[model samples]
Target chain A: MKRRSNSDGKSVKAGRRGTAARKRRPLPTAARKRRHLRTAVRRRTASVGRRERRDQRLARELDDITEQQRATSAVLRLIGGSSGDLQPVFASILASAVRLCDAHTGVINRWDGEALQLIATHNMPPAYVELRKRSPYRPDQHSASGRMLATRAPIHIADLAADKTYLGGNPPTVAAVELAGVRTALAVPMWTEGKLVGSFTVGRLEVRPFTDKQMEIVQDFAAQAVIAVENTRLLTELRQRTDELRRSVGALQRERSNRLMNLEAMAAAISHEVRQPLASIAANCSAALRFLAHDPPNIEEVRAGLNRTVNDSHRASQVFDNIRALFGKADQGRQAVDLNGLARGVLDGLRGEIEDRGIIVELASAPDLPPIIGHRGQLQEVLINLVRNAIEAMDLMTDGRRTLKVRTERSAADKVSVTIEDSGPGIDPSQIKGIFEPFVTTKARGMGLGLALCRMIVERHAGQLSASPAQPRGSIFRVVLPAGRNAATDATG
Target chain B: MNGQPEPQPIVFVIDDDSALREALSSLFRSVGLQAKAFASTSEFLQMNLPEAPTCLVLDVRLPGLSGLDFQSELAKANIDIPIVFMTGHGDIPMTVRAMKAGAVEFLPKPFRDQDMLDAVQAGLDRDRSRRKNASDAAKLKATYDTLTAREQEVMRLVTAGLMNKQIAGKLGVSEITVKVHRGNAMRKMGAKSLAELVRMADALGVRRTMS
Candidate 1:
């Protein structure tokens, strides 16, 4: 309004100058000099007035621009800064809103469907905030802020005492607003893509209405507030997604390494387990060939070599069968397996190994023992692994006393057990408990999975395998399989 | 070529695998190499084997003391036996380590029979040379030990690239006495020349003082 009036005054003065110029030839020199002086005075004042008015307008525009820049940079900083949590960002939004509106108290609300949620506040006394938070805030048209929410516009009240809503209505908000000693307040609606998200509210203690410029400035601050909240929400979500991805990757890495370790163990075990039989096969073959090539052929020795070769080949194949059973043998239906017969078969197959290690075996099985229903191949594997461990244990002894005593008997009326005892150095009492776990090894070249696999096989048969130190020397392994009348079984006994 | 009979050549095999041990013994016997197999090192050490040109086929991964450790132990006990190592699982580093310890061969299992025979033959040859050099030095030392002290001193000087007169001067004896000792020493040592005496002296490790 001031700028338009100033321009109108200049046009009227210009029209008077044009008429004076038209009558200049018909006038005397004195009259002409007076008009020129008067015109000079008028033009001088007009130029000064225009310069002063322009300077005033620029100053006001610069003030408004500076406020907008401050608010914008604050919001941009919140967006770019480290805000893993949005608490600090919320507080900053309220701080800017309160300061920009020149109000003593402020709040930022989040709309969670039918009610307003007060997320953050600045200069709000703890008691006052707690009181307002005691109940849900419904945005109704009865209150000034609610009116703004309904219209998607800013609502400024110069004096709450004169506002109609506060005069006679909704006691809670009016009371809450009054508790803060608020006489005037501004509530600006905040929107994101035309959806009403929340609002920024400011309250003054004095009874003075906010001007149009102050209302506009508060809206700008409200825009900055909405940006900070949305940015914080997106950033938090992204961080959570990244955290979940990293955890899954860590799990995958662990699984892959475990599989690789299991593969390496299988290879080492095959090498340690199968090499002995293969070696004997080669040796026997060479012996047989050499005997046949003799001057007077030693038919007797050659026959014995051929026989041993056959035995060794059979044993080598059995070694592979045992390893295969341990790896991934599909369940070959359980059968009534004679414990004594199985033990004898295993011992017969390992005759070369026992003799090689110079070990003496004492097998004592009670007669008329009931057969247990179990996987024959798997049970043989368990026995082999246990017997092998016993042999290796006795390898430390140089006194030439390597005795393996395997006994089977009815431990109870309903259960039978086989006890394999070694005359090698006894297991340490402390280590007996954990010796059956995977990767628990007593031999340098041994893959510790032998005993662990044995225990797993026994457990799967609804039986128990345990270890104990023998009296004064050696170690004992006992496998107890319940006679099939037990509750966990309905098969052959 | 000497009048004494050459001892028989034998192969000693020490392994914990019984079938392998038995087969190897039969194989060696078929070839007339006189092979003996033992289940363990202790079993081998229990009996006294013949003092013949012999080699040992040792399993590298034995029960108590490993074959490589047994090698160093043999050296410590002053047992001079050449060894050919056999293992079912032999790696490169193990082979290198065995070779470094003077092993004749490191054979991984399932090796060719000829390879075993070759390794045993090489081991036996190595032992033969070692024994020959040792016996020669022993014989020379025994002859040197039988000399009187003065004759021994004169022999030492004579074989040390010194003149007889200088030897006599150092021994504080007359030139004629030095000549008598040198003659007795050469006759007892059976060294027909001064160079032969010098070689015998070197073999016996007989040191003489320089004056």
Candidate 2:
């Protein structure tokens, strides 16, 4: 208004000067010079006034731009601060739009392709808020939001009371005009990735239409609302994917450990138990022949060689006895067995295998450990199976050290225990109890009888076999057996 | 086949099983070779070996380190003992690695007694020849070091196939002076002929100063 009046006053002055110039043209040269000086002075003063008005207009525009930026940054800060909760974010966005656009009330409605539901409202009257809560709004030509829904564009109503929806007695529009005293309104549709997600609408209580700048401010708020919604959805999706990955990794590790144990058991069954005795037998026979072929016929050396052959033959047959004991009833071959010696024997038998796999073995045998009474061979078989399982378990570890620790100690006055631990991927705690059940092998090959037979042999001797998790990483299997009464009696005697 | 009095040759057997190690020792003893047995490589390594022709009978799979790794360890420690590798579960890749590292033999168990004996005998022969060459070079170096500097120069040029006059010119001496140095070098090195002198020079890695 001020700029327009200033321009009108300057034009009126210019017309008066033109009429005065025509009258003064008939005067002398000195009078014309004085008139020209006066006119020049007046023109300078008018331009100065024009410049001041333009500066004031520019300053006012700068303030409006600063206010718009401040409002946008506040909404952005709220979106960042609230992790995925969209309630406060939506409220803040609608409130800013209403305040920045010089309107009385603002609302954000979520459109689910069928109807628009009011999700957020700011400063809306109680009657209007209650009227919209009764039912969702479907797409209709009479409503501004419905028009925005159909066109997917911003809609502006200059005067709500003169609008057809108000005249036709649309209940929400009538509530807006009579209850809230709203006239001018602006509604902008929110879009996310080319899909219309919702609408942001603000209304004024007086009949003053919103300018283009105010319309743009509403659009900016709608876009920020879209970002908050999309951010929440992506965050939820990422969380779900992380949970799924963790579950699969755990399952794969369990399966691999089971498979490795079974595979190593099969190989150990053939290579160590059977092959060692066979090789020893062959070597003894060859030595015996060489001794007999001596120039003097060294009968003592020859006899020693033949004795070794006999012992190795017995050693070879023990492997079958173990197999039979696995399937049939318990053997009657009980004896006074030192568990420390048994653990050592098992480790010695697997020395080649241990070295081949590059595993470091640490044996901690307690001094003067009380002896246990059991079938020595079956007990040795149990220890061998456990140690073999430990080795195979560690073979799967690619990063950590491959270490096998075999420990023996007297657990009680009447009991001796052997523990074999490995640095490998440990067993799942939930599956620890179920692992000893028959036919529960995780390997693709072989009958899963390794641990089952170990447990059976242990129980037959009145001993207990159990598995547990090791520290840092890996698994441990411990065997506990009763002490030998005969050995104790002999020592006492 | 020199007539020097040599110490008895020994065969060292390294096996994890004491029974198998004893049997192998007995087999070697019956063939009139002195035998030593150890339960592991560490035990064998701790022994102070005598200066005699010796060979090792190594089990491919042992307690601490595999036989292939042991072979490299020995090389790293500058112990050039000949090894006869025996494995119960010999695979082709293991055999290739052992043989590539200069093992005397890679025999899978239970090998024939004859094959074992032959591998042992071959390993002993190779060790004897290696010892002989090393001693021969040492002796040649010692003898070459005893000569005067001019005599050593004459010897290097003589081994390079230079004539007496050319050697004299290269050394800035008269032909007679070069001849005298060459004679002194041959006598001190115990070379029976010029050819023998040249062979000694080559063994000592002598280079002609001129070229």
* Candidate closest to the true structure, highest TM-score: 1
The candidate 2 chain A region of ten consecutive residues with least summed lDDT is A439-448
Query: What are the Cα lDDT values of the candidates?
Result: 0.76, 0.78
lDDT of 2 by residue, A273-312 (tens): 4655666677678777877877778899888888887887
lDDT of 1 by residue, A3-30 (tens): 2312224446657867975863556789
Docking class of 1: acceptable
* Candidate 1 residue spans exceeding 4 A from truth: A1-55, A74-78, A81-279, A324-394, A397-493, B41-50, B63-80, B155-159, B208-211
Please give the lDDT score at residue A33 for candidate 2: 78
For model 2 the local lDDT of residue A469 reads 96
- Looking at model 1, residue A147 earns an lDDT score of 80
Model 1 chain A — which ten-residue stretch has the worst lDDT?
A1-10
Model 2 clash pairs are none
Task: Give the range where candidate 2 chain B is weakest over 10 consecutive residues by summed lDDT.
Answer: B202-211
Give the count of colliding residue pairs in each prediction: 2, 0
Q: Given candidate 2, what's the lDDT at residue A417?
A: 88
